[model samples]
Target: NLGDALAAETGFKIEMIPLPMKRMGPELISGNISFICYTLEAWLPSVKEQVLWSDVIFNNQNLLVSLGAKPITSLKDLDKKRVGVVVNFYYPNLEDSFNKYQIFRENGPNNESNLQKLLHGRVDYVVLSSLEYQYQKKLQPRLNAYDLGIDTFGVKCAVSKKSPLSVSKINQAIAAMKKSGKLDRIFRLP
Candidate 1:
């Protein structure tokens, strides 16, 4: 819906392609897909030259969550526990931090799988974006979240290295939308 709104507002028709987030890296690198709409942090420096970040669509903060248990308050609290994490660039920070105290186990594919693991006691806790966690909590009221004082980041649409046309157009459209408040209106829509 947000992609459609951006297309409408900018007069640039964006092809909304849906793929599992886990496969996005390989697909984008192999040119199977030309663009990805995800958090800016997902862009690895190795692939950075192939992509351009545009338009801050959402603020994503990683959160530690568990099922109705006392919220995990510190890195020390994670010791010897299995932590579910999504695969990709975001895991490096978590891996480095959590490995210091615990045996970290990654639950891959997507958030649904990770959440299911937490629900079924396959893992002690999971790391996810706050927005995603909130949405999931609506589906599973038994879950609880904790903030670990990490800086929140922006989500952006990334264009492939070969698609200079798309990148240029998208950046221009995003700048125009930002100036005109169109982006704000789109996000505010119910």
Candidate 2:
């Protein structure tokens, strides 16, 4: 849908290329990838000089999720618990907790892998973006999402400096959409 909207506004075909989380930074720095959205600029600090970050697309928060019956309502509830997570992805707010070994991190390849781990009882809890949790909730209604009151950050589009499409052009289209309410409509889409 974003590709369709971008193509309509920019006259260029928007091709999405999927890369492993581990390879994303390297690929972007090497100009082998154009862009990725729903990403945090903080995650790409190593390649900050080689990438262009767009305006904030939306705000998102990190939530602790579990099966409805096993609701984890607060941070204290996570003490010494193993939380499923994406391998190599940083959880900024949890760094201190992780460093102190107060909570354990159980790595998986991606969100789906982590969710599967949770559902299959491989882990007691998992972290998910607010938007992602909402989408997953639609498919599995027996899930509970708990906010830790941390890790709230802006989500934005990250464009490689070597991308064929300039950030300015992309920004113009997004700005237009934001001003005309198209962006809001997209977020509200079922």
Candidate 3:
């Protein structure tokens, strides 16, 4: 949908690629992909010099989820508790706590696996992106989510510096999408 919007807004061809969450940045940096949409600036640390980032496409959050019966009301409640987190994903709010042994991290392949770990008592809580949590919450009514505050992101698009697309063009496309309600249709965002 964003590809369609961008093509329409910018009068240029837009090719969308599906890559693993972790692979998108590297692919963009490696020039294998021209651009990736609806991503976090934090996700493209090394690409700061290699990509032209659009204005925020949207805002998103990462949440800490636990079973309803054993709710974690606050981040401090996670102290000394095992947290199920995705492998290689950054948890800015928990890094120091994990390094200081304040919380224990149990790595999983993805958010779904981490949620399963939480459900099975393998971990006290699981960290998941808002989209994943909302979708999973629909299927598992026994789950609850908590905001860790700093887990929010200004989601944007990154175009490789080599790409013909410019930040201004991409930003205009995003603005057009928001004006037309295309973004809401795509993400059903807050």
The TM-score values for the models, in the order shown, are 0.78, 0.90, 0.85
Q: Give the Å error, residue 151, model 2.
A: 0.9
Model 1 residue runs over 4 Å out of place are: 20-32, 41-43, 98-101, 175-190
Cand. 1 TM to true fold: 0.78
lDDT, candidate 2, equals 0.81
Evaluation by lDDT, superior candidate among 1 and 3: 3
Q: Name the TM-score of candidate 2.
A: 0.90
What are the runs in model 2 whose C-alpha is more than 4 Å off? 69-73
Candidate 3 segments whose C-alpha is farther than 4 A from its true place: 1-16, 20-23
- Screening candidate 1 with a backbone cut-off below 3 angstroms (N, C-alpha, C), the clashing residue pairs are 50-161
Candidate 2 pairs with clashing backbones: none
Candidate 1, residues 1-190, lDDT tens digits: the string is 5577566765755687677666666666776666766557454555655556676765677888899877677867777888887665455456666546565867567778888899889988888777777678778998888888544777787766655346667777767777877766655422
lDDT of each structure?
0.70, 0.81, 0.80
Which tens-of-lDDT digit does each residue in 1-190 have in candidate 3? 6678778888988776667777877787777877888676676666666678888888788888889745656668778899898777777888889899899989998788888888888998888788778888899998888876738888888887767777787888888888999888877776
Q: Which window of 10 residues has the lowest lDDT sum in candidate 3? A: 68-77
Best by TM-score: 2
